[model samples]
Target: MERTGTEPVTARSALGLRLVLAAVYTPLFVLGAVVFSLWAASAGPGSVPSGDGLAVVAGVCAALAVLAAVDLVVVVRRRRRERGGRG
Candidate 1:
């Protein structure tokens, strides 16, 4: 059967995608935070790590989180609109 735009994507599918992205990104972010924190803790009184590596990883994970959040918001809004129409 041919699919059309009128059909909504399932909530489980949307949530699964969001959760998968979150699961993948959360660890990377936490790892980067830990490494950066440890490096900072070990540094001299007036020094920080060069931080380039940590910054890159954190940036990537932050970007992924933002995208996932946007996707989740869109999915939730769509679901709400669908339900509102049905009532």
Candidate 2:
């Protein structure tokens, strides 16, 4: 479907906002993964089963990072297509 008048602008702006949020979250998620990985690695094998917990945290962070990256890519592609259409 084609966007009419201001609708395209609004949709583009929304995508830009989402891209910004994704950019902000990507680093945070990466940092969380790094921290969790370190904590998991440092934990003693015999120590309380915290490794599993840390692993879960790291996994979640990794997933978030992947999702954010995907979102960024999609938004950028959409913006490119929009711009290309206008030219």
Candidate 3:
């Protein structure tokens, strides 16, 4: 195909890539938060000394996961709009 300036150039979609990454990592983050929360909850008087630090970890992980999920949703919506809202 001869190069023509009139042709629409289709570049690789970084937004799509970001969406995939966010979607994939969101669940992992959520899982980590859940596991850490469970671990913090399981601490007993006879068990290792309880620390508020563990709960902090869980909260941070959960917050990051939610942000990632929101990012994924935003990217998906933007991509759809770029595609003329076909989706």
Highest lDDT model number: 2
- The deviation in Å at residue 36 for candidate 3 is 0.5
Clashing pairs in 3: none
Best by TM-score: 2
Residue 83 in candidate 3, Cα distance off native in Å: 0.4
Instruction: Score candidate 2 by lDDT.
Output: 0.84
User: Which segments of model 3 are wrong by more than 4 Å?
Assistant: 1-13, 45-50
Candidate scoring better on TM-score of 2 and 3: 2
Worst 10 residues of 3 by lDDT: 44-53
* Candidate 2 local lDDT, residue 51: 89
Q: How many backbone clashes does candidate 2 have?
A: 0
lDDT of candidate 2 over 21-83, digit per residue (tens): 988998999999999989899988876758888889999999999999888888888878878
Q: Mind giving the per-residue lDDT tens digits that candidate 3 earns over 22-68?
A: 98999999998998899889876555646466778889999999999
- What local distance difference test score does each model get? 0.58, 0.84, 0.83
Clashes of 3: 0
Q: What total of clashing residue pairs does each candidate reach? A: 0, 0, 0
TM-score, one value per model:
0.47, 0.77, 0.74
Model 1: colliding residue pairs? none
